[model samples]
Target: MTWNSKLRCFFLLWVLNSNIILASLESEVSAQSDVKDHGEHDNEDYSLERAGSFDQIFKIQQTYLTVQVDQLNSTNTPRAKDEKRRLLKELSRAHGKWGDQHPRKKLLDALFSYSRYFERNIPDVNRWRQLYNHVSSKHKRLLDRTVSYTKKFDRAESLLRQNHFLCEDVVNEALSYYEIGREELRKHIADAEKAGIVADKMSVSQSLKHIGRDWTDDGVSERDGAFPCILDSIQSLFPNRQSSRYKVLLPGSGLGRLGYDVAALGGFEVTNNEVSAYMNIMYRFIETQSKKDAFQVYPFVDGWSHHVTQDDMFYQLSFPSMTMNNSNVILVEGDFTTVFKDSKDKFDVVITHFFIDTARNLMSYFETISSLLAPGGYWINFGPLLYGTGPWVQLALDEILTVTEDMGFQFVDGPESCGSLTFPDKKVRNKEAAYGYSPRALTKNAYHAQSWIARR
Candidate 1:
């Protein structure tokens, strides 16, 4: 009786344990399935289109606000005053249009008006004092009331706007005005701090001169010697006799050495376009200095041509001011990317030295150069493409070449020339080694850079 009873009891216990384990496994699988389903549902609920649309609107608004604020904070000369008024009018109109549609619109409109008023009138001590007194008199109550009202409107608008996801496009447009208001507020603070502080004109002029000459070897002799080499390379590509009265554009003309040299060549009319206002001022200063030094040093330099006559000298401080010069130098101050915005196949030669690598938008520079070049016109670009900045230099080259060819320019000369020029940093024996160089360098970091002559 004892053996048979013990076997039956053990079998029953084992069967019960198996049933319990199966139940637990089924429960775990069901829980996991529920979790997966919940995650999928959550993902579907958070629509990417909705979030992306909102973000786009937000950014547009931010930019608009910034521009409006900047305009308000700008110097209020007659032109600036007119611009401010126009901007304020536009802001008011936008506010009026949106205020009726959205609750936050009124608050946003008030903020815009306040910004304009502050920017336009705060410069007057009397006006500012009056404003301060008014604000101080009703400080606690008015501040609380304004804050509470704005919050309420903001919440209401947010709730209403969320339901009308289709109106994301409209909301995006309103976002621009909101951004303008915000940016103006920021500029108002900055302009307020800068008020009454006049910049030193002489110091600014000197700083400009230094910046113009910064990239070159600082010694007067070195810069003077370099001019002949630069002109030789320039003349070799486009011979002086055949070059005619070619319209030459030299951008970043720090102190106008290259432009002055080209002009002095007699055949080519060089226009110097310098971005820095200080550089332009310094360029004029140098012209005066050149006159003073002309008798003493002009005859010694063999290549120094007198073709850059006083009558032939022309300069543009900024891009827009650059006059179309067929036989004279045109100095233009502008972002090279937008240089040819209105150019009508006018230029015959576009030359830049040590300008390409320094550009932030390398492709834009090449692209602009290609666009500015007339048919059969020469594009001379000489610069260090790859320096200490590793992959970025390579990427810039790729972008420049890609844009150059895309804009219908053909590379006509070698970008592979290897030569040793004196390093700007004279302290460094191995220039490449000084800038964290490895043995397996992708491009040469030698003192002398490669030159490319392209034709469009």
Candidate 2:
């Protein structure tokens, strides 16, 4: 009787324990499912119809904003006053249309509000209490613009939080990213003041456009295909990756990611050349001086799409601490052509990406590379021949090749097409249209983005 009662009690306890375990597993799975659903909702791609209909509208609004800003800053004549009134009206209309309902509209409203703040806050002569307290009109204007623009970025971050399309964490990261930039700029300004030079003309705003991209690894999907190709070419030339230490030049190295990778992995002495001041500053900061454990930024941070939720909108970006502190990675800031123009055959490999188009003269680039590389040096190039210069100066791919050949460089490998370049949440395709936009011009006109390895 005791054995039978004990066995029955044990079975009852075992069944109860199994039920509890099943309930916990179900709850865990349900939680994961909820997360997956939120991810999908946030990351949904913009529909074709929505993109086609609204992308043009977004572009128009952006263009209008740019034009209005220009007019506001122009000569202060009667016409200029009228232009200001018109600009304010346009901003009012935009605010009225969507208010905070749309993230992009909210951003525009923030921008317009800041512009008005700038206009109204211009210090008057009477405001100066003492001679030492007096500020130059130029310095006042610059301060007003900087503070106002910084506020706009702050406001944009706030508005973006209201929209479910993007991640608030990412938005905050971007805001912090810009704030860091602003602080870095203050140091530069202080240095300029100490030297008795005007730093207001540095155009900090213009340098911002591409700095975030370089600070993150988000653009790898579009532009990183050539990284492997270039490495392979260089390794083949040397064969012994561990023993051989080759001299490498990365011209127009935006953020110097590829160059950094080459030096770290290929055991090469790499020099990364970037011409833009802000880009170089940010890149160098991340490469050497970034105080943060890891830096994060949204690539193509400005562009927003109607097709996807804010969550799926920005590419989640972070650059790992692969700085290769032990490796010989140099960051040089200057015009690539001019910097290496007088260079002898000092470099074993020269790598260029989305850079050749920045050249005013394509022939100049060829000549510079030829001079910079050794007799058997390899020049690895990726990116289209979009002709950054005027149409008159723009040369076709064939013309570029002919000039390189004339410069005593022969093909080591390929002009092989990697793939068409496309940015995250952007309508523009390829490096050309991304940089320059025209509704009349086709976006995907150039294709078969070939990577070439030319040996001198």
Candidate 3:
């Protein structure tokens, strides 16, 4: 063989080997990047722990109150009024101490937001009124003050919006006062419990009694209460059925307000599937009370109350099995994405409030809903879409809507305020003027939010 031919052959072989190595390196990098992206997305899917901090605090408070109440319940001797006052004072002091120690603006904001959300959503008017009355007067006063402060803060926000200067010191001072007010208000719940003024379970009879009471008024009315406005919008979408045969399902049904309302609507059989055992037990107790009262009222007001048979209401503390039934309101307890993967039947209407945005897998939730909802069925949901710690790693409203459309649902209506109450700006909007600011542009880094309603 010639020397030139040998050199050319060697160079070509070397070039080919180099290209193969480069391709291999590129593939490895691409795979690693894909894995990293998947991990990041997975981390953002659900924020159960993030959302539960306030719930944990409230639960701890409830535990202490329950223990004290049990002690009081077991006692044969009736305590003097003075002793009651002392107990109340002690409880209030304990709560105040805890609040001072925690001192989390985020926690306070979340609680207030959740309460406001509840006040707008839940369907039952009577239950709403009960919850409003259940809140301590001190809490009410503080909430009122917070609302007023929020309006003032909004003025500053508006000024900022218009690119005007705001005093940062003034804003900070107002926020400080608002925080103090919230702490004081929290103490009121403990104080009330110590005074033996507890808001017990709302029986069906009690709920019915409160119905139609000041329906037009938003001040502690039967329809506007603790659960929120989002829940009510979902309820409104369930067209009235003549027979007590309609079935409803609620996954992640915390405290079961929406589920109970569906059951109360008469013709619908409702199931509340909750992940938390504590929530499940609480819901079951409430449902039992409702059933007992319902049985009592059923005979006299035939057709006034939609008769919900015990068999119609089912609950599972885990994810639902793939079985579908026409008369069943199945509450499946499990990871929402994995549950019903093989389910053959779709719902007439799927209801959710504040559930989708809370999930890191916003797309998965929408896809699951689309799969579960029958053609021409409705998807009724309401909740604030805001950036926060926990499940919501980022605020991507456009991304969310895009995913919803991909899942075959159309945006029906909403982004409207669910209830009569105004958004509290004191929590979200910064008041730079109150806090003392130099003549610099105030960057609007506030969380953007809107309530939505969509249909399939």
Candidate 4:
């Protein structure tokens, strides 16, 4: 409110305006100079856009739309933003400029389908897609082949870049397409009123395998290699086939298939535990289904890399190859370290299948595992050292055993040769094994995960 302060403020604004004016004049002079200095070709018409030929314009349009749709995928989180919606709307209103061969419409449709299904959620979309995969071999091939031709249209980097959307305006258009899948996912959740699925809840990059790799017949091969160990341990401890004699706990039981198989084989009270809501929803969904191998999964729809053909991405797998109605298998849902932490001297056998490395603190897991087992209980583990997220203490095989021994447990049996992951001085004659993988996939993840059977 003082004269001096008002004068100073006016002076600053005047100086700023003066500088902007100067910059504008300088830019104008530079443009004029460049035009004057051009060679003799400058005498001819130099209008850039107007001078282009029909073919040039066509190419421009193709590239522009391609880049526009490509840019629409700059993010993968959500579609509530105004700019993203505007861009998609602008493209949609373009009046079908591209010819029949052009991929504008196809790309647009694909993106739309992705948006609607995305509302249902990624795991839901894939689970819904299982319907397409399970219909028949002939139809499955068609869905597989279609991806080969449509891969380049436009997609984000996740899930093979399958889902991206521009606006909520058009999201409803594809609802009918997505609703069938929505209902399927809902029904799956509705089917199983109780029970849960195992999940680490990592990003899609890590969790995608839960649905894609955990249930397939190929995935079963990994479990098949580990199952015998549990059976052998059980038989060694209690030779009789009593219904409730021995108590076995399986943590990180994705899809509950491993536990299902163990319980199906009979003789022990088996408990399967998991933490992922997505997996839990699907598992419960499978619980109510009647047909064996009726559920299908096309998990690689977005996993375009390390695949030879589109069909490779369409690698369909029918799940629960043989569903057993086992009443003895118990579904316990919660984190492994906390759910049964208060209990002591309970479990007869604790099984870990590709699960031990999921711990952040190896000592805590050992402590928990040790606390749960009876004095003569067996702690059987088979998995690679693929440690989960951080603040984790990663120990070598020797270091892990040392820690296990420190937890008031005695080491027994061999780190023994089984899968390709076991690295003993002498080569073992076991078959090459993978946790979860498609054998024909270009990138091979086959490894001999080390195996061990310890006694408490």
Candidate 5:
């Protein structure tokens, strides 16, 4: 009787425990499903979409590089062999010293061709490990397609694999910046994970190509075409010039050159706001430099095309040709609209250099600028309307001026040429501004950037 009763009680206990475990498992799965659902349904997906989009963004980057390397290394087809011969011929012409016998030719082959510069100790590229483990099946297509249709770049071949080194420069710095950003982005992802919600991804991917030359003295001509005009307008339009330094907002201040220039020139408190993590870390990198010409930049190492000479093709220049660190300059990192949305009338002047085109909706940017500037504050813009990527409304110059005026601004007469090259369309004074321009390069991507002085 005792054995039968004890066996029945043990069976009852075991059955109850199994049911409890089943219920717990069901609850956990249901909770995960609910979180997944929220990510899909909510505007801000706190799910796989948001969390995994930027996860291993470097995978695409590296894959693209690998694709490029493969292209340069490929000599299978007739076209490839012809291309190789052509490149060797070009190299032969480049340096009477460019031949195989030259010391630098051998050195460059070791430095770029065979070196693990893009991998190994590089912190930015290496940091992808954290994000690499999270790319869900959904976003795998992005990684797959980045280099799928990518063809050999229509560039001159480099016998020593020197053509794409410009990409290497920017990628290293960009990935380094990505490392800094990755840490911050992980924080947001973790918070969302704890809350079981999808978080918004970090900053949009911005081209970091300019980062290579942003801090260099080679960029001085580009700056002269814009920065001096920005300062002149600020000094002329701003009141109480001698009394106190006026707050000037410089959005898209890459590597802090324009902002530092204004601060160094005196009479202005410069706020350098940048969105690219690449630029921010690079700026911080420059800020830490104790001496001038601390770094070297090869702006044209990638420009195998559009070059008349080997010197132009393989020019070497020092970064920060001069480091003008001023305490008056403060950098704010984030989107222009989001960072200063609430700060109405906070700036005495707003200067945009090659920045207006950065907006998809120029009206939104104008509104933000209007709100940020106090009454009688001036907005001096110097940049061509080269609307790039995304859904940018490519408005004609006349339309832009009209819309800008409609956005509650009065164009004040200024200099005939803001800096260099003038465009005569509207009565308002405007001019062309060049960015990343080097006269040394046979081909230049100079822009007739419209310049204007508008009062809010």
Candidate 6:
């Protein structure tokens, strides 16, 4: 027991205790960081209050949950570690309030029920919707959840059916939705099974083979009507234009709704040019069936902003079929770039909605649109530059204006900002919802769009 030995022993003991304390502190810091990263801080309440209303709060909460889970899953390795660190830094700043757990699970339940209805004839959609809507409005989260999950499950199902590799979580979620509602949606399920109607087996046109499921519910025309300033300007300018003599061309007229609107004015021979056979078929079906009161189509359901309900699940598209002045309406099935290139007749006007950006060479649109229009006739356009991955470059506002002017057209008005609306119903405006797919962030919804009325 010399002094040197005692000193060495003391040093060893101190080092051991210090290392243990450091390790424990690091572990505790990591745990706190995880909770904070999720904004589920132990100390703070992130309850539904921050969102103003219960529904709003529920959406915010659900979005956070969905996004957080997605981020964790989608990012692994260095990025994942970085994200975890970012979460920790964010959490260290504040506490969260916990409201009664948002009804995220209820959404899954409702989606399972609604999706089961798809197993039967189309009318069964309304039947299932009626029962599902009977739930209290307070639980609207259920419907919203249904929209979110339906798409996820749809994608999952599509991949599985195609024999594509599926993720474990996606497969589990799909199975849960498929099987969970056997008891809850029992009657609908039974009715579906007895009816022996399968949505997958139903015969559809070749054009609709894989992706036309949602075209019939295409509400773009309804939304296009929201551009009153643009539409009004065109109508006023062309009021004196002869009805029988003046021809209107709508290139990229998806399902012909917007073009129908123009033809229904009864002043122009409107020709709807569409490349997709699915849309052409739908346009004809809507026009031919206009003799009926209303045409119903089953569209895949999803949304972010509106209260989710089974009522929101499908579209009962209304056509002013009985009253519509559609004698001048015609359908031309072909690509716009080459469709009318050889035609001897020219048009009095060419108007487009959401079509310009679809062009492989956007500048070329000016040549086509101008060629279609008569001298001093108008070319009015509306739509966002929603560029998903594409083969061609997108044109900015200046580029669009320059191209039109260079093509020997006089700019009557825009390339001017007229606030855009995607849905005609004001209730749904600016309400945020996320579809499962993520387009390029920079290109998606860069909707600082303008309406241009140029005269050729």
Of the candidates shown, which would achieve the greatest TM-score relative to the real structure? 5
Model 2 residue 436 lDDT score: 19
> Model 1, 268-356: lDDT tens per residue?
76666665434443333233211111110111011112323311111101111111112234445445565447556456788776666
Name the runs in model 5 displaced over 4 angstroms.
1-213, 342-345, 419-427
lDDT of 3 by residue, 1-456 (tens): 110101111111123422311121111111111121222322221211122232221111110111121112111123223322432343343444465223232223222222222122222433444566777888878966865422432332222211100111111122232223433434543454466642322222122222212111211322233234444555566555674365455666664445644654556655445543223322322222201111111111111122243111111011111111212233444456764575565776666644665677566677777777777776765444543466634545556666667666676543233432223421111111111011121322222224445677
Considering summed lDDT, which 10 consecutive residues are worst modelled in model 6? 1-10
Clashes of each: 16, 8, 41, 7, 5, 11
- Please give, for residues 304-348, the per-residue lDDT of candidate 4 as tens digits: 478786557656566555543545565554578976764443888
**Alpha-carbon shift of residue 242 in model 6 (angstroms):** 6.3
Q: Once model 4 is optimally superposed onto the true structure by TM-score, how far is the C-alpha of residue 438 displaced, in angstroms?
A: 1.7
Give lDDT tens digits, candidate 2, residues 1-456.
110101111111123422311121111111111222233333333221122222121111110111111112212345334433443453343534654443333322222221122122212212322442476777757866865422433433332222212122222222232222323323433444476643221232223324333333443433344555566656666777677688888888866767766765656888788765445444533543222224343332233333133333333445543332413566655577765554443898888876887787767777788788877888887677666537336776666667677777786544223333333332112222133111122232233444667888
| Number of clashing residue pairs, candidate 5 | 5
What's the CA RMSD for each of the models?
A: 32.0, 23.5, 29.8, 25.8, 25.4, 26.5
TM-scores for candidates 1 onward, in order: 0.40, 0.49, 0.36, 0.54, 0.55, 0.46
The local distance difference test score of model 1 is 0.40
Task: State the weakest 10-residue window (summed lDDT) of model 1.
Answer: 295-304
- The better-scoring model by lDDT among 1 and 5 is 5
Of the candidates shown, which would achieve the greatest lDDT relative to the real structure?
5
Give residue 355's lDDT in candidate 2 (0 to 100): 80
RMSD of 6: 26.5
Q: Which candidate order results from sorting by TM-score in descending order?
A: 5, 4, 2, 6, 1, 3
lDDT per residue for candidate 6 within 1-456, as digits (tens), equals: 110101111111123422311121111111211221222322322211121232111111111111121112111245234433533342231324322121222223222232332232323434545566677775767656765533433432332221111111122233232233223334433444476633231222121221222233333333433445455755777667563456788898765656656655556677778765334433443443322233222232322223244343332333323433345566665678875776776887888767787888776777788777778788877665666566376876666667667778776544222443333422111212122111212222234444656778
State the weakest 10-residue window (summed lDDT) of model 5.
1-10
Per-candidate Cα lDDT values, in order, are 0.40, 0.45, 0.36, 0.49, 0.52, 0.43
